[model samples]
Target: MDDIHAPTVASGLSSGIAPRDVSKVSMPDLMQEKERIEAELSALSSVLNSHGVNMNSSLTTFDGFPRDDIDIAQVRTTRVRIIHLRNDHKAVMTHLEKGLHDHFARLQNAPGATSANGTTVPSSAPTSVTDNSIADTGTLGTPFARVNSVEPGSPAHQAGLKMGDSIRGFGSVHWLNHERLSKVAEAVQQNEGRPLTVKVTRKNESGSGTTELDLQLTPRRNWGGRGLLGCHIVPL
Candidate 1:
């Protein structure tokens, strides 16, 4: 494992797990923490939106006095927290990137290692890096959505899809052009019964970390389940 040290954010807001702590943790733990921070940031953003303000919105009137329209103190606090979390998010991502490199390096260095005789050697079951998608662990890109549910014995299950997997790419759909997941629907509809390369970042089980995957999902209907994919997804 790599000893990655994340930068600290200076703010009144809690800085989340310390850099030293992260250095000792695995990639999956870091990923979960990243998701937690993102969720909090989303909630705080909603608060600002509810108050009819944004990060760039001025909280002062032309007279330069604090505006009475919104709760200035709460808004300021939320803004600070958001900023701090963003910085923390960046740091965690950096650590994750380094961890990913180290993980691959280990795999490449001794994939199916054998003795000098070169006879067939028995080894431990390949560490289940997370579901059947483990073999498809190279397309780690920016996630646009997250799997919320997956029906058993369904097409999604057959394709190795699992709940909580963050979707990076789905056929022609990606983070920048997902368009509120409308593109996802379009891709699915257009590629029904055909294999679509679905990329995702999945958190490993137990004390392990996270891994990226590229599943070949062939969407169809009436496979002992409702809908084509039999899964629910929500935008991240």
Candidate 2:
């Protein structure tokens, strides 16, 4: 009886970064595969957070909900949930496709992605959720890392490093890669440990144009993590 209740699945396949389909499997297989997928996704929750879907868009906020679609007086929570997931499934598939493509593409680009040594290519490791201002985040015209959100007391935060500022030159190099900040810090002591200079650019609100600015910052002391600028930096 329990086996009869499993969702039917189709054959596993790929399409434009499509999520795996398991429709051909039996009830037990479906349950096992679903569990497997869920387990595989657990390590990347930060990158995989599925906020409630906004049917109105990936580019716009969902201005309204169809709450009134059902007669509230008779609708049950189970019914509401089922309906919501049904509506959200399409959107979920779209996002999944996009994510899978990105993930695989990155793997392909990684060193040794094609050969055993390919994946082992010598590369600057990525920065943690910490300081990344070491690299040249300065740019001649555009801002550096997409300023998703800036902290309240960090140097940039206090100096008016508002959200959306693209840091271009750190001390004198591009921080676009985002790992330079950490690399620069490791080399700072060798370079005299002076206060670092940064160049930042951001869009003009009026769309008139972009503007450039300069900032000076010293590394925070006793930082808990490598390359952390002692600021709360979140991805945009």
Candidate 3:
């Protein structure tokens, strides 16, 4: 004969009996215990979420990195630093662009600056000596030979040739193309004292491509590179 009463978990727990010995605890007591455990779990979940963990991952092992301590001030500092770097970069770029533009403008203006003499400084740009009819005339577009600078005593200078004049026409070639003009200039450059007849034209008016000065002269080893006259000719 055996005592048929089932043991209770609370009595066993209080008595230091293993939970496995629990067989019959009142329904209400079990329900209360379950509710208390659920409440504790809910509180723990809330704490984890505040610390940066996503609450949805609490029940799943696959839930990614658990939330840890969050520092709002650190995040703000990082953002500000990024913005500051971007602004500084923009400012530096703007300054460099302006400087580059100013440098080029100075280069262009240098050609027209005045010299120490009372007379307005002659332009530094190169000149050409030729007639209007390129080829057997004056040719333009020939970089092969350009007027360097007119010498103080030169035939082209007497002919009023200036610096930066381009040969536009040559014997028998009017409106000479670049190729033909280059060929003529090449010949003139080879023979410095050959007394090669040349022509130079200058822009008569600003921005007026059609209007230009027509001067007929000869090639001379002037001040600059192989050009049409004796003075000086520099690249434009």
Candidate 4:
């Protein structure tokens, strides 16, 4: 974290660019913006760590007096900035998802055709739904783990994962192969920077029953949070 200077929270914790029409932006540009926000968030987290505090750490004692061990002023300011950056991160991810969807749509309508956004598709651009389909969603499998909490702006949140969602499958690690959740950790490690199909069952909006959902989650380090998924999971 010290390798990268912590951003000044007061200067604004946005992605360091003016808001533009996301539809008009190219997919690559959107991805770059996402990376930028994530890096800043990671740096901010390091700053908080240096101050010996976390988002949940109390800044005051039981008597409501400011604690003496840590910098209360800095901790409060950093917390606020992290909140703002998390919101910004979520917005950028939304735009990135839209860009990916639009990219795929254009490709389907015209195979190997130039992107509608007019930027030359990079050779490194992902080609398959399994690789980059953030919107490719469906339901399958049996429950193995349950999402107890989802952190805002974390990869789980970016992928539309929610609290109380029951994890039915995670990539190749299904209910049988999960090995008491160890395989889930292994899958996340092995698939860093690559999207993994996460199948989950959640209560329907109508509240009558449950429905399954498929989400593409990419895990990466230093996402300004504690874990790559920014979520807490427990075995069913």
Predicted structure with the largest TM-score when compared to the true one: 1
- Model 4, position 60: C-alpha lDDT score: 67
Cα lDDT tens digits, model 3, 47-103, are 545545432223213444322345333333333333333443344334433433444
**Per-model lDDT:** 0.74, 0.43, 0.42, 0.71
TM-score of each predicted structure versus truth: 0.51, 0.32, 0.26, 0.44
Clashing pairs in 4: none
Worst lDDT run of 10 residues, candidate 1, spans: 1-10
lDDT of 4 by residue, 124-226 (tens): 4443322323223231155778999999999999998999999977887664335457779998989999999898889998989988778999998888998
Q: Of the pair 3 and 4, which is ahead by TM-score?
A: 4
* TM-score, cand. 4: 0.44
Model 3 lDDT at residue 170 = 39
- Candidate 2's residue-wise lDDT over 1-236, tens digit each? 22212222332221124544543444344434433433333322322233322222132225533343333222222223333334334434344334334444575567655545544544343332123432322212223345666655655465566777776655654422223244445544444435667566778999989888777756554434443344443322
Tens digits of lDDT, candidate 1, 1-236: 22111213354455454444567778768877766776787789999998999888887787666678888777877777788777777777667656765665565557676655985445433432222243244434568799999999999999999999999888767643354687789989998899999888899897489888889999998899788899999998
- Which consecutive 10 residues in model 2 have the weakest lDDT in total? 52-61
State each candidate's clash count: 2, 32, 52, 0
lDDT of 2: 0.43
| lDDT leaderboard ranking | 1, 4, 2, 3
Best-first order by TM-score = 1, 4, 2, 3
Query: What are the runs in model 4 whose C-alpha is more than 4 Å off?
Result: 1-24, 111-236
Candidate 3 Cα outliers beyond 4 Å, as residue runs: 1-148, 170-184, 189-197, 204-211, 220-228, 232-236
